[model samples]
Target: MIKTTFSIKDLENLSGIKAHTIRIWEKRYSLFTPERTDSNIRRYDTNALQRILNVSYLNNNGNKISAIAAMDDCQLEAEVKKHAEKGNTTNHSLQEIKLAMVNFDKNLFNRVFNTGLKELGFQGVFREILIPFLIELGHLWHSNTINVAHEHFISHLIKQKLLSHMEHVDYQPDEQHKELYILFLPQNEMHDLGLLFLNYELLSRGRETLYLGTYMTLEALEHFQNKGKKLVYITYITVDPTIKKVPKFLKQFEKNVNKNGNSDLWILGQMVAKMKDLKLNPTHKTFDSIEQLINGLETSKKLEH
Candidate 1:
């Protein structure tokens, strides 16, 4: 069964509106008419959520709450569309992307994504739009606002876009950068979208990278062999490698692949970030975010020059 009703907090989270302000809008502006529960708590339907998002978008774009409240739902949505067409603010684009996901509308998703690319460029779209959208998507998933299918649908679409962009980035191995960056996801870890984008960034910056996508094992690294150049193995552990197993996995990786120190491991994602006591080998490193990892790599490259 689908979750059609949401609490006031969900509305605030999804719309970026304050719960107090939502209450005010309910009492003063009559903007929302959320139904009350048996105990008098408020419950809002999907339409209310969409309307508040639209109102937030319009109000952020200079429309007054009084004026927004006066407009009918059609007018409010029209105003939002008009403003969205004029400019691609991060918030507005995020809302459109969320709606696209909820409705499973490929055309709408493409339209918003393409618009963002045109205005923000690929990196900007990813940093400003897609990243935040994905973060919120996670929240939605945990809140039960969306199911796994929704997550998969949107993830596949984003992956396709990332792959398409990556294909355009042609990089020949630079003699100066002898370090080969190999990106992958650990075994049982299927979330590779972040790693995919990281590969694009690496390739775009002229880093020689081999993307050995999801469900990879440390033993698999042996196949690549040490060709004399340093092999920098990178993986984003969004899931899998449960906290208890991360240390064991790292130790196994050291034993299996990096025993000679010919390779270095760069671990990332929420999993490792939460492991406050994680000890790393002198050659290994941990990054809290993609940006940090990218900056570290770029700095290393410059130092090499």
Candidate 2:
């Protein structure tokens, strides 16, 4: 059996409820019956944590604790589900997901993701919801609304989903077009889900890719360029290669890859869009959105063939 025990801190972090309030609920309404550790510490199980979250959600929306505590399991779950599904423009669903992540609630995250995917297909969920959600989460983290552990939990879950989709795609190289695109993030740039998903999108459309994952060095890339392999280097400029270093980095990249006759560099990201100093060469391009980049690639491919 999976042990569902959680420390007091875990409960607080997960539900956004104070430890004192939780204790009061436990004493006043018999809200949770957490098992005591051998040394007399309170340890909450998964069910208890879930219940507290449900109660907290209701309480936040003006439900009284006395009434919420009287609710049966089925009733509480139904209420939570209703709230989740209701088209409330003011609802902070992403914040709820963040709370779930803080508590390490894999089930909650999966439920939310799957629901969003069902309502809006993978592309829609990715573009409309997940992307915006990630950006907002980053803001929350930087503003001290959430911590690193919470951010990491959600990031890992999203990465797993992206990797699973990537694995399912086919990536056969076309002899007629023996070009291979390699995608990666530079050193200290750990955000790669967008790049990974783009790789999957390209692979699904019968394009070849050599995904280098996160934190690749410039030196390592130089060794991978082969004569027949028309190289296209793609990266998202989220972090590292800062605004100050972008001009130098692009200069070095051009110098390194210009030796290969047929090589191009494409960049997409918030930082890339904001870059004004870097003068892009004929073989270099920057796109504001993934769709724009893909469209450009398709146009380029048609022109080349």
lDDT of each: 0.84, 0.75
Compute the lDDT of residue 271 as modeled in candidate 2: 86
lDDT of 2 by residue, 90-181 (tens): 23355456556656778977877787777776666667667767776766566554567777888899888888767766666555666688
Alpha-carbon shift of residue 228 in model 2 (angstroms) = 0.7
Root-mean-square deviation of candidate 2? 7.1
How well does each candidate superpose onto the true structure, as a TM-score?
0.87, 0.67
Candidate 1: which stretches are off by over 4 Å? Answer: 1-10, 18-21, 35-46, 58-67, 74-88
User: Cα lDDT for residue 82, model 2?
Assistant: 78
